[model samples]
Target: MSRQNQGNCDHQKLISETDTPSLHEDANTDSGDWFADMFADFEPQNTTDGSYRGTMAKIKATELHYQAVFEQKLVEANTNLKRERIRVTIKQTGNSLQLRATLPLKPGDNSVGKQKKQYDLSLGIPANLEGLKTAIEESYELGKLIARHTFQWNEKYLGIKSREKQEIKTIGELLDTFEEKYYQTRQKTITSQNTFANYLSVIKRNFPLTHLATKENIEAIINSVQGNKKNELIAVTSVLIKTFNLGFQLDVKRDHVTPAYREIPDDEKIISAFHMFEKFALSRKNTNISDEIDTWEMWRWVYGMLATFGLRPRELFVEPDINWWMSTQNIDHTWKVNKNTKTGYREVIPFVPEWIELFDLRNSKPLNILERKVEKIASVQNINWMRRDISRWFRKVGIQFQPYDLRHACAIRAHLQGIPIKAAADNLGHTVDEHTKTYQRWFGIENRKKAFGEVISQRSLIELQKNEILALRMENETLRLEVEKLKLLENV
Candidate 1:
């Protein structure tokens, strides 16, 4: 049998030999008898073979031994308490240990409308050595309280202070508290504030002031949504729940949303869109020459940058200067994405380096779309507006793909050009895993076939060339043999 089972059997035999009730009730008996019986075979056998299983077994054995010691200490404390007239005995009740004492209660301390003895003052802690020591100290404090006639029946003594009723807060009121704390702790950027505001709206929609922030109500709200939305709801709700210590946890798995694959536009389509952008600019120009400020060329430049660099639509509005683009420090001619952009600052290299010059991006002026300041357009409130305007402009130019598709196209371009996954990810401001996931999912069989076809074609061409060389050598040998045979005929 295992040592642990043997020890347990031994413990049971020791308990059977002594009166079990006496062990609980009688404190006058010497604790040493119990201690000796419990620990007679408790010493570790030095079986410390360095393995996880062995270490765990040792730990478990040590824990059981300590528990036995704690129990002995409790019994010893009772004997001391009885001799000192403390009038309290420590008892092991279920999994927890408590001080059992008969103390006089103050007036109106009982539901019977009369003063009487109160028993079982809870320690409100786990039954361990530390808890035992703390409970003994508390017993001393209780004894003093009884001596001073200050002892009373209160939730504090019963360890129900936290369980006491508190005023319920409205969802709206709690949201106000959450907002104040959220801003105080988090970075106070316009984008961050706007994102928080969006989260607040989600919370408010599901749980208005009329709805209480109860566990049941939150579950109901979570259940109302499906897929990624449910996960998002749980995520935002957790922030509020944790902030207030709401005494519950969300135990939901993130429902994986199968994203729809967006096809990356080819180089031809992107180049076509660049030409269309010029026509779009001409179409937007006014009959009154004074109104024309070359707005279309600015947008065309934006399109070229997006197509060439794989920049996020919002990233264009982030403050970038000619110096930033043409910095001497950038040996690779890579430009820095602004720190305020979504993924923060990253150095982005164009997939097609020649596009920078072809689009005349080096000589490009600061964008002046709609005469709006760069900061104003890129601000949290208007960033969406900027994206929408870009989208609308694309539609006017008869482009079929969305603005973000260009970013995907760039990723594909980088993949086709044999860019390392890490390099591609770093340039695009994505993690390697994210880059792999995005491209590999849609990088698909067609691209694979194309790559394989190129390899096969090269191999076939080499094989054909080798065959031609062999045929030429055979022909030359045949001509030499024919000439030698003719010489023999001439000698005859």
Candidate 2:
């Protein structure tokens, strides 16, 4: 029985030995072979006699521990990434940090392949999550503020804050944009085009964009040119204000560049000038000299047209088919004078008898003849030259007035003749308020008093006539009574 138990124990020991190999034996065979193949360049110093296997085992254990630690760290990193609400990406080029907040897509938004909308913080990388969150919140608030003002989330609104860094850094560039916008939208007339061109040229030549950007700089520019070139300054300043307002949405007041005070000439001087030119033109017409007749006739028509119709110089030279006659024979009788008008179009009545007579004479002639004469007159080209010629003629005739003064005189005449202010303004192509303000000085209290006095005097004259007629009838009755007494005495 003892011998049988010993044999079973030996068999159990043999099974255990076969199941588990010795650590040294395994390290020398399988582990050593794997380590050598993996790290062939690793040269372990075999200083102790049997230290090689132990060293290999220690290295394997160390590697396994570190691998487990590395796997744990990777899992923690992925979990932290899932917890992040805002993803911050830092760009190296602009040194700007972009924060993308994970928000639900807008209702109509189809973010099929598009990346989420990211708000640019334009900041450096924050030291921590708290700092980053603070920056993102601040940026989001700023964006909200910008949107509140009705500005788009674009460079245009951004440029307003950083104008110096904007592409339109110069005044010329701004004006160019303004002019382009103006011409694109507004109706273009030759006079308006010329005027805008002149404005652009003057501004480009005189003022720099940087200099006119601020109010103080603009004021300084105006002050420098105020004394001698006040009119030019006024024009340039107006253009500048318009350009800046349209381009940059700036508000530049007209009062900032007030024009110098201009003295309006007396009404008598203006009226006298008109009469003087009329008499001179009539004298030329009466000469009956054939060669000078056409020239004299042209001047005659011009004088009558301007004085009667209160027309600008350019209106006289409109296409003759336009029929400036304002006759009842035509549709309205209120002639529409729309040629080169500063305020567009206006309707005027033929108030002057001479104007009617001149139109009659013109209609009597062939259409081609009238057109030829008009072209001949317009051939003078420059209206300014025409003004100079008219001024020179006035000088020759001992009158002191400009061609524009004639229009002013017409305004005065309209006021004195009891024409309604609105009617006069419409005839003159001006707003009633504008006409009133401009000609207020001409419509003096003294003139009103004189008109009232004249009316009263006429009524008093009628009363006096009635009283004189009654007294004469009484005297006639007394004479008849004397005659009757005389007849009775004769009969006795």
Candidate 3:
């Protein structure tokens, strides 16, 4: 054997003799001298200061150890390749490693007059012991395929999508790349899909395709918009910057405000709207069209649930568990929001418990109608469709208030009924601070007057009682004086 081959064999023997280092070092173990035994001749490479100490030193040691181990693995791989039809080898570039296969062409079938063609298939694997093992296995598999003359340059061998790299020259192309990468790392769900849709909408609406995706261009696009739209643009643009590592910071100040809820309808208006819906549905019942009547009633039920439960519009279709609350078998009326919801699983109580009976919510779920609708729609569209449909229906029925007005109205009602902010926030599936910020802004003149009026009435009643007590005391004193004077007169 050559001296180089002998050195590799000795290195392999030395590694086998000692305890193999784990990929993740134990936290309790001393970080210093942790890889000391494994890499006695460790030298620092691609590091600043060139000191064998601290976290950087440990990382350098680990990298060098992985290199040594990979070299030993390559020696074993070379031995295995002796009997294989294809010449398989390991190729390392920076921190990543890949397998290169040289396939022999058939006689008189040379392309470009070459006897063999080498293909470097990048698996995007780390240059660690585990990655080396995977690459060696892939090489053997490739060898088998080449031996059978069935080898082709494809994802089957490359371990990635077999598509030509598309050049991203414009913001639009960059967004496409970012979108694919964004979804690829996440588990697809109705909420995530909807979130992506909203993000893409904002990005596409604000950013022009002609502009290059640079730090200056992104900032310019963000600066052009104002308020919440500016904040939204910043957020989605930041995703692209981060995903692509476009060395820049999104330090622009956010639009510091929440949507104004002061125009939210009062309880009287909300109740009035429900009554109008009830009237409309009653009017529809005489039309002799079952579907039309069912639609009206179903919508009325949705309105009632929103007002009674203070539920978000999307939560209407999310099917938050309230059957137990509605069922006669259970006494607890606390509804459970689904785990898949934006705020996740939490218990909620009816803000207007009496509204349940008033709206006939207990007896009228319209379950069959909702099930049919949900069945026909795609899973991702389930919540979105419900929200839009309810909004359209409300407009068609000539209701002045939006669907979320009911939720805002419910929040206000909970506050008016002296519900603790924390308790209300918990029921609403948000923080106490968020609940305060949202509802407090909407606690306008009307709410303030109602609150102040209660205190004023109580004060006035107390003042009247004190005046009456003073008059009674004076009368008693006068009667005592008259009685005493009469007794003296009689004695004389």
Candidate 4:
């Protein structure tokens, strides 16, 4: 039996050695109990480099909270803003880190394309998102300029209590608002409308100027406009003068208007009275009449009136009030011109016989109703009424010349006459120096003759003085003889 058992064992050994190795039904997996004990959530499956994969992770469930705060400082010296975006994605480029922001263009805001070459500036953006970044940067940049203007505007409107809204992102808008608030309401002269409108035009069309709202920029812009080859240099130069005087004080600019590029056009100085009478007063009937007897008689009358005696149109209109014929007093006597007006200055103007005749015809006295209403001339705001009346008169007379031209024409005529410079200045309410400079060009040959006549008159005064001295001596001698005779008669 031992030998048989030995043989079976030998046979088994030979089978194990020769045949393919056979395994048990299941291998023992419990040998990794130590690993399982050490790490219950993870286990190595293979004998190779040991690493395990888990279906669910025990990683930290950290609540990733992000808070982004944006702080912006305005270009204005006194402005700032704080904004927050909870979920904005912060991006870091090779050069800088930034956050993409979506900004909307406000209504009426100027477009990027509309900006002038000088106005357009660099806002760095990556090639990947250029448009969006540019828009964001530009909004803030433009906002800065607006903020600066707004602050300035507020300071200007300091004393006046107002419910006025603060707007005006662009320089054009700001100036428009200021003009409406300040100039249109307060400006005294309707004739100044066109002058102010010209300023408005410059503010709008000049793009480079719009960029320059500050004082320095304004001067630069004005200089730039003058510099431009396309525009009239005089127009721009005038704008600079007016803006310096009237524009909102941006601290960089002056409060009053300066005659920086002052050029007084000879025509601009004194309006041609003849032209104005023909344009403003005459009926449009071309009768080929002589200058002495024009088809337009009323204008001729106006010319004669101005040339004969210096009278302002308003003064002519005021005759019924004071009843010049009844009172035998001019406006200077009726009302203290200087006292009534803000500035105390008198109206030293005089009227001719022709003007008096016209006044007599127009006079209506309902206890002087015409005079009562005309104590103060009605306001001619924007010159709508004045323009309408002027247009009608011009159309009738068949040309274009404003009523102011009459004043200038009268000034020229007086200058042509041997009227003293001071008298001419006083009649027209101008400084003597101003009148001299303006009308020197218009003094004709007749004027020179009148001037020379004055020299002859001066010489005549000297000769008359000499004759008076001789007469006084003769009278003294005669008086002495009479006294001696009276004494002798008394003795006899």
Candidate 5:
């Protein structure tokens, strides 16, 4: 029941459609809301369910192709320091149609951990079947994830054949292999590994295994992602698909085994992914990563930079500007845009005067706060990792966070500050129509926040009474003195 519906039956309650934010610096709309509102309940299909019946038919035909080979099976147990034997009994559950490893811990641990255990996943596997390709994708996917996570933590898998046994696999198989490998070694920033991860996930969830590229699968996967992911996906997929079109090139590369695999995902189906990020910043706190940073200040910085500014970790080093906005603002209490914004294209965000002052102070600091957290940056392949790490820290302090939640929060903040559609566009360097059209979803929360600014947000902010205010005043005075000294020197 957003102000939009006013009282319109909660506007797709089951789907929990996201709300809008304020205008951009306006930066942009609030949420990305990319996916179509596909809120159909998971009604178990009887024979009469037409869509299920058809999907089942297709699934049966596809499963007929694979000959699932269960290489080995065993249960492994470990005794904790408490001398408690955490024995996990594994079983190949569900009909042979799918192999689901029933863990002793059912409904699994959905939290941050030392070493992430693997979940036995059903990759669109049918309920019951026979000679139809022995559907063990679930087991296979689980094994791969386990091996991958184990390798990452440098943890040992004493049980049966780890994934080191397999060498040649299809594109989908290759990606799952890499995701585990990349996660294990803690290599997060690499583009290819992440790209492959997205590709495989989409394929696993939506597309069938008959082949790498199909019209429907491509469209479906495309429809799966929206916004920045859509753009990035498009950029990567387009390049590869075009290469895929080069038949001889693709063949030669296939023969030689090079970096020329172009599994083209559909463009039209690529939804605006920004909406997917709505909410969750203050959800699912990650405790492990919290142990890494000294203060929540760093998390706030990360949130402001990414969620508020849309600056990637790599883009943190924007060139110096006239005011030299290293981080915050200056003497006259105004924010400064760094020359890094030299290409000078910002949309949906504006260099507010107060913000300028904030950055002016930040600018005075050394150019490399990054030195403190290189390890963290080095492992940032997926933004989700950052979210988890931050969430972990906040959770330890009793806060919730979801990955990329900051970005969403920032977008919402920008819009709420009453940033115009065009300024918001300039702030983000995106288009304006988007700002106007999504006026509701991306703007709702922001609108609410703006509508009731200090009452909620400034509550804790008001905690900056006594010496905290003194510190700010002193800082501002110091800048003023420095400016005076500079003036005298110029006059001399």
Candidate 6:
């Protein structure tokens, strides 16, 4: 018989032998004999009770032998090859084949690490040996074509359907699509929109949209940049991952990629920065009485607002709608955070009454009491620029500090004042655990020890009270029993 005709007979025989009622009844006998013959040269390390498992083992061994023979032929065909190899495997699904072709690295490969990767091609093919052999040969040829282009394979090369080809978009193109979807699907605040725009700009600046979608390019870009620039690179990579995930929902083929972030330690200690900033703010208020009082007062309010409310620097100056600031009839009472906050909406009351007076709430349109009319609503860039000016001022006064340090100072003050950790976190619009992790050192060892001692003392007192209650109960029971006996004796 021809190989194709014999394969057809074998397929029919396999289905008949496995599924027929009479064969199933005598499966142990018939299948064991069949598997023993098929795997005569192969030995199974572990024993199986059923004939089905044994048959499967024999089939697996046969497939491995077939793959090994094909691999040996490829090796013989290419004598000087070092690392490249063709791996063929039949899918367990019974109607598919898989081919993996690894391309050897060139002498000057610019990949970050020396890891072997391959181009995989999967095809639906018949289960018969002859059909599998033909599919494997076709896959080998296709893999060679892919390798010749340095593994930059695309759907066009494989002649995939147009629908499938449309899914294979470059990373940059997918990001643009993702950004469009983001604006359409999400209700973005002005701050959020600005942040998204910045992320898009950074990604486009660093990566070309025309390049193929691969993680290796991301790695190379990250490696090419160093120092502070790496932070921007990592930020871009993070946005890319988010964009790709969004693209996935639209059937785009941009896989997620992660770029490693450099872990640079903070040099400015929170407590030290706080003290220095406080002195600077106090000096501004105390020293200049005549010409610069307005300027000094503005800095004072800025410092006080950050320290008192833990407000972000930009929050104080963001577009001055009524939502930005709220106050009660008096400056001393708790105020509502009427606007959208970074960690969602939260209310923060000042510790001191003077903090609230920093805002000119008498006017229907709230403005900073110290801000000029023209400067009432400052842009985010101007806010940041002012913060830099404040930093320089601190240096001129022989202090090292930034505007953000005041917020940290607020957290530390909250810890020192014996505020409940959860309450403090809520006031700052953060979780208790996050608040603790960020400012645990500022809480001081003595505070931690005091907290620990209080807990231990409370537990000890509870145990002592429990013991006393138990002893009293026992005494009362004894007295009751004696009284009952006396009553019985009197009745006798």
Residue-level lDDT of model 5, residues 1-492, one tens digit each, is 478785444334311211111210111222112111211221222221112233344334323321121112122111110122111222345432323332322233455543344334333333321111223222332334433332222212222232343233343543444444333212122333444556556545544444455334444555566654444444344433432221111111101222222221111111112222222333434545553333444444443444435443333433223233432443433223332221222222333334333422253232344334443443324343644565564454443333234333444455666566566644543345433533444445435555577566666577657569899999999999999999999999
Ordered list by TM-score, greatest first:
3, 1, 2, 6, 4, 5
TM-score of each: 0.59, 0.48, 0.62, 0.37, 0.32, 0.43
Candidate 1 structure lDDT? 0.68
lDDT against true structure, model 6: 0.50
State, as a TM-score between 0 and 1, how close model 4 is to the true structure.
Answer: 0.37
Q: How far does residue 279 in candidate 1 sit from its true spot (Å)?
A: 1.6
- Candidate 2 wrong stretches, greater than 4 Å: 1-115, 118-178, 201-216, 225-296, 318-334, 354-398, 443-453, 462-492
- Expressed as tens digits, the lDDT of each residue in 1-492 for candidate 3 is 999999888655543422223311221344233233434443333222111132244344544565565577556555555433335677787656777777665334559868777766777655544455556566656655655556665555555542333233688877767655454323345555776787778778888888887777888878887887887787778767655545468768777755654477887787788878767766666688776676776788888888888887776567545456567765556667765565556677889888877887766447556656666766766668778988988986779878877777767777888899888877876666667766786778888888889778889999999999999999999999999999999999
Off by over 4 Å in 4: 1-171, 180-198, 201-346, 351-426, 439-441, 461-492
Give the per-residue lDDT digits (tens) of candidate 1, residues 335-444: 67776565566778888888877787665353434235564654566766666778887887789989888887787778877799888877877666667776776676
Please say which candidate is ahead in lDDT: 2 or 3. 3
RMSD of 2: 31.6
The candidate 4 region of ten consecutive residues with least summed lDDT is: 60-69
Give the per-residue lDDT of model 4 (tens digit) for 1-492. 699999887655533432222111111223232122322222222121001111011111100100000111111111211221111222434322233323233334576864221122223322122222333433343334333332132321232222232222346545655454333112223323444565566556664534645555555554553333223333443444333333343223222333222222133322343354444333434444453233234434333343334444433332223444345445333222322121123544442334444433223332243344345455433233323443354445544444544555566666645578787776665556656754564445554676678778989999999999999999999999999999999999
Candidate RMSDs in Å, in order, are 16.9, 31.6, 14.8, 32.5, 30.2, 21.6
Candidate 1 weakest lDDT stretch, 10 residues: 45-54
Residue 360, candidate 3: alpha-carbon lDDT: 79
Better of 3 and 4 by lDDT: 3
Residue 89 of model 6 has an lDDT of 30
lDDT of 6 by residue, 119-199 (tens): 344453433333344444554454344434445445533436433634556766777566653432223444445556667
Quantify all predictions' global Cα lDDT against the true fold: 0.68, 0.49, 0.66, 0.39, 0.36, 0.50
Q: Is candidate 5 or candidate 6 better by TM-score?
A: 6
Model 5 has a clash total of: 83
Q: Candidate 2, residues 1-492: lDDT per residue as tens digits?
A: 699999887655544433333321332343223222322233222211112233344334534543344344334333332233113232222212343333334335587976444443333332222223334343333433332332234442233333444233456556756665344222344445655666777776777766435555555666665443544655466556543442332233334343333333444544455466456656777676674444434544455556666666665554433454535466434456654444444566754445455344344343444466556553324544544555565575566555555665567667767789888876766556656755665555665676678788889999999999999999999999999999999999
